[model samples]
Target: MSDKNDSATVLPEVTFSTFVLSLASSALVHLGEVPNPETGNTSRNEALARNAIDVLTMLDDKTRNGLTPEESKLMRDVLYELRMKFVARS
Candidate 1:
């Protein structure tokens, strides 16, 4: 039998879309829209949420015309959804 960590989980592949989604997820957590996976609690912190959203926006701007269509759309959609949540929480 091989000695290996059977409980080790595989990580998701890194891609522009996945990166965008991760950032959006963080924004959602900060907005108290999604529970923190680590704590199983939701709490609003507009500053952190806005910072995450802003970082996403900046990433999109800096990567314009450099991403695949799907990636671009993913970024746009994630930003839109996060923005709406941020607004609602405000």
Candidate 2:
């Protein structure tokens, strides 16, 4: 018989912070800052990256004061880094 505890193990639940990070990572990949894991290729798509960054910025603004400290910082840092990369690529 299997242990009941084995069935209790669960994957990490997705949160706002994780969702934001996911988008930031995608933008980085599109900007060629990070390589595509599956294709082993880096491609620059400033238009798409910029759009993703804009979406993040809008989310941050809309969710201001609602996020936990860590969540807020993560979003801010990701946005800042992505913006810098976008400018450097431009």
Candidate 3:
């Protein structure tokens, strides 16, 4: 069972939304917006950030018409936030 408090003992359940958020987290890390969980470092790598954004964009494109309304909205909102952050970083 996934436990929020005992993360070392269990991971979050796999789901489309979680997957998208995972990728977005990685993108944020690359953008130096969020610290790396393991290293406690924040570093920018625009190429990698753009790559993640592209992958998420592709996901949004490919998953269109297939996702629940909530899932779709999450994707759109995350992408929008990431893009705006990326622009500001640049």
lDDT of 3 by residue, 59-89 (tens): 9999999999999999999999999999999
> Clash number for model 2?
0
How many angstroms is residue 54 displaced in model 3 relative to the true structure, after the best TM-score fit? Answer: 0.4
Each model's lDDT: 0.90, 0.90, 0.95
Candidate 1 Cα outliers beyond 4 Å, as residue runs: 1-7
Provide the lowest-lDDT 10-residue window in model 2: 9-18
Better of 2 and 3 by TM-score: 3
Clashes of each: 0, 0, 0
Candidate 2, 1-90: lDDT as tens digits: 557888887655688977998899889999998998889899999889999999999999999989999988998899999999999999
User: Which has the greatest lDDT?
Assistant: 3
Candidate 1 local lDDT, 1-90, one digit each (tens):
434785476668888777888988899899998899999998989999999999999999999989989888888889898888889889
> What does candidate 1 score on TM?
0.89
For model 2, the superposed segments whose C-alpha errors exceed 4 Å read 1-12
